[model samples]
Target: MMRGGSNVSDAQLQQILSDVPRIINDPKTADVLVKRAEELGQKLVTERLRMAQARDIFDELRQIESIWLREPERALRRLHLLRPKLAYRRARVRELGPLAEVLERAVAEVVSAGDAAQRHDRFRRLMEFMEAIVAYHKFYGGGD
Candidate 1:
């Protein structure tokens, strides 16, 4: 049973699974499916972050920063993956000027730090950058 009181029976679930090949064969439907999957992934990440304690968030952010420090290109690619969701959230919360400013600055710092040669400095900047993101989500509910 799902939150809306709709129960997905096994037969329906099996039917959907049986249609997988057809779904993949149709380009338009496949594209829609992929987009929906991405949105779901973003929602899951947001919910996890929202439910996490500050210490847990900090630890995860540090791990991400460490990855960035060690392999900047990979980190940049990972950050790029997050761009769409971050942009959406920013647009939704544009009225929060100060928070938006901080987020913008942090994003810029992260991008710039990717090119920086000093690992220690880059790590610190990356931590600050992620902290800003965490702060935004904490203060304001993650945007729809």
Candidate 2:
């Protein structure tokens, strides 16, 4: 979740926003960057399915809790350790460098529109495009 109040950083937000499109356009890059992020995602789904099947055979919430719920400390430590890895991922993406200036010109045209509704629609479409990037990144590892 995004942080609330004035502490929010524009750099971070822009990074997030900037990422939306590239991720959609590339999935292999994401996979390579994220240490089997795609494989892990599939593994997660498979584990969930296995748990559901196990639930049918055994009604033991306590067992499930023991297996999954006790890992918060480990998860936190992993997050800390993974921070550098994630940073490298972001850096690698940036190394590919800036979007073509033409895209910026297109955006400027939308931004310059006098109609607020038109501007809103333009931004919304941009967001959708970005979301596709995210989805692509999350799964296919930047095929392009």
Candidate 3:
């Protein structure tokens, strides 16, 4: 049986957040990323987190990633803004539950990634992780 916290018993998702950089560095990382996300997706489904809730959060993250940055500070400001937006979203969509918990960890990682270069890398990995999560969430039958 699945074991760990209600969100993800062992904080596997949290590990995935912190491991993004190392995972990106590994020569054999690509499939590892997908495999990990797929496992998390199954857990998400088993926990009954809904697809819409996950997608809505992803949309906000995507918007942040897609913005053009003439000044790097603008991107950081946006990232800072996302934290509260996520909090408001989680409060509104209680069904988000563990998924929000997981996303929050990722946001924390991105915000504290230490420097501009590292932050950008972490952000991309965060996007990849969430994209895989959303795709696998749909693949595993998560729905409204």
Candidate that scores best on TM-score:
3
Cα lDDT of model 3 by residue, 3-97, tens digit: 33234445676676566555444435768778777767777777787887788778887777877245566777877887787788778766565
- Model 1 lDDT tens row, 1-144: 122222334354344434333333333454433332233223333444332433343564466566875787676665554445455655654433223333343444445443355433544543543454454444334433
lDDT, candidate 1, at 32: 39
| Candidate 3: segments with Cα more than 4 A from true spot | 1-32, 68-71
lDDT of 2: 0.33
What ranges in model 2 sit over 4 Å off? 1-106, 142-144
Off by over 4 Å in 1: 1-63, 92-97, 129-144
If scored against the real structure, what TM-score would every candidate get? 0.36, 0.29, 0.74
> What TM-score would candidate 3 get against the native?
0.74
Model 2 pairs in collision: 23-133, 24-133, 26-142, 27-141, 27-142, 27-143, 28-141, 28-142
TM-score-based ranking, best first? 3, 1, 2
For model 1 the TM-score comes to 0.36
* Deviation of model 1 at 123, angstroms: 4.5
Best by lDDT: 3
Tens digit per residue, CA lDDT, model 2, 76-116 = 34323333443443354442112212123224444454664
Q: What is the lDDT of every predicted structure here?
A: 0.42, 0.33, 0.71
